[model samples]
Target: MKHSEEKEMIRDMARRVAEEQVRPLIASMEESDRFPEELVEIYGDLGLLQMWVPEEYGGPGGDLTSVCLAKEEIGKVSLAASTLCANNSIGLILPLLEFGSEAQKRRYLTESAKGRIVTSVAITEPESGSDVASLRTMARRDGDSYVINGQKSWITFAKQSAYMLVFARTAEGKGYEGISTFIVDCKTPGLKIGKAEHKMGRHGAPSYQVSFEDMRVDADCLLGPEGSGFKSCMRILDLNRPTVGASSLGLAQGAMDQAMRYASDRKQFGKPIAAFQAIQFKIADMAMKIGSARALLYDVAAELDSGDMSRLTLLSSMAKCYCTDVAMEVAIEAVQVHGSYGYSTEYPVERFMRDAKLNQILEGTNEIHRLIIARELFGRR
Candidate 1:
């Protein structure tokens, strides 16, 4: 698979931005647990924020593979900065690009590309967890508007987004059949943004719990069609899962890069740590794991771009689960290679460890992914 010139340019640009801007803000943002608002503006200016959007909708018209390339380069410097791209490509902007109405695209996608607004997706609830069908959010029709009532938890960028793609029950029934999707203005009445969550890492990207009480939107706000929310949800994951996997791939590669540099530069017993066979083995293993994960993730991304959904679901799960696990393992090894400095905030490996842990839990837990893969293997679609 040869890389495109556009993708190469995007990767180089992301790397330069991360090195010059995002990495400089990492320490300050993490200390304050505040999202890096300035860096996001920079990303928007570079068109990285809307790379997932099509050209017709006012974006760079890049594919998932290009987005992954950009993410890997940025993650090498700052995981939180890379997340800004992930949030857009995976579910937020991609969904609208895929299913939004012409009017919706013209307004939302165009503005999103211009950096006029930030967006989020609200699906996970407190009780529902990974059970998308068990969601308790209800949107009752009232004349030309729908009144929504529910709470969404662990919503990425909820506190900062100007709009959110909300999934709620629109009819009385069991499972996913009654669900629907809506694009709600965050300023809508009765929509309350909760406090930013204090997390283990990636503090530069914040998450929150959002409560919708009597939040009302016009009928025009509905995305796709009524009772089609569940299908849209599946489609969203199918499209962006490869990007999630790539995020983990980037984190692992970043940790490996840092560890390798430290090993070659730092000395132990009056000699460079790189000279020790034990340290050499760690570097070798880290490189191998990172390479393997990148291959799997990019293969899946290529399939995504090819419009061949045949085994994408299985491959995406494999990429997300395997790459994230490798990220955690490699990050820990990175810490081990650096000894005490790795455990401290002085080195970014500790942050990498924390961010990599979140990847496994979000975008469907690894346990659930295993179930999906097993189901696919058992001939149960």
Candidate 2:
């Protein structure tokens, strides 16, 4: 099917699921810090969990644009749920689909599509953060298996995931060339999950510290080839970052929607707030920013689907950074237009604002993306 039709279908499905399954539980989920397993299952039944997997692998074979549109719709309702879905769909599944062996795909992707397993990507260490190549995690070869010993931090869904796509150093080297990727079951003997992190928002999706002490995995667990993990991870990020931007766009859209409704209904100075010039200007700015960001996100997703990977890393970074920043700005301004009511939990704008802040930090930090964009613009020659 054509990409546009696929996107529309996914969007409609996601909107219905979000409203019926996610919106009803947002309050309690956030308050209780619970993962929405039921919602995940619903999405799985709708083929969203495996949208990008090839049809031969028991998936819908949807393009990246469809994935982004679905994520945007889900994000409009619950950022936490949208984030968990996006991470699983892109950060975990995309790498495996792109680089895993046929046997590996058969083993994992099939189960993952059924929502029988949850997966996470482990790259950031307590000491590494944005300096991915400087990671200290080590996996040394021992006969047919490698023994892994390291600590990974800020891993989303780590505690609940059934597997992790781990990046570790296999050789003593100066840079990314030494890194390799492996698929490790969460039940591995030496893998341990630390306490869940307390965060500003998206508390429904918890982050955790994962420690690997002498964990053993067979050579078959290796993804792609040795010394290729960094490139694989980068490629996955390029394809997925547009969805992150789309999530931000979703939050911005929700904020604008709430603001518009509140402005039109709430009266002040004997008139509807929306009728005032000050409120009109804020609404106009929010509309323009959201529209522009949505365009950029969709454009990048389309380019990725066409296999025009060139310049996309930079464009994805740009979209992620710009759209997220705009999300935060628009959400904050939306609250301002709502007055004191926006500050209370009774309103969704405050939650939208909190959710918008998270997009600036995930996928890749906006600060790191700026460096990437600058390098691309100036030509790394």
Q: Would you list the C-alpha lDDT of every candidate in the order shown?
A: 0.84, 0.85
In lDDT terms, which candidate is top? 2
Cα lDDT of model 2 by residue, 206-282, tens digit: 88999999999999999999899889988888778888887788889989999999999999899999999999999
lDDT of 1 by residue, 116-153 (tens): 45778899999998889999999999999999999999
- Evaluate model 1: give its lDDT: 0.84
State how far residue 7 of model 1 sits from its true place (Å): 1.3
Model 1 spans > 4 angstroms off: none
Provide TM-scores for the models.
0.96, 0.96
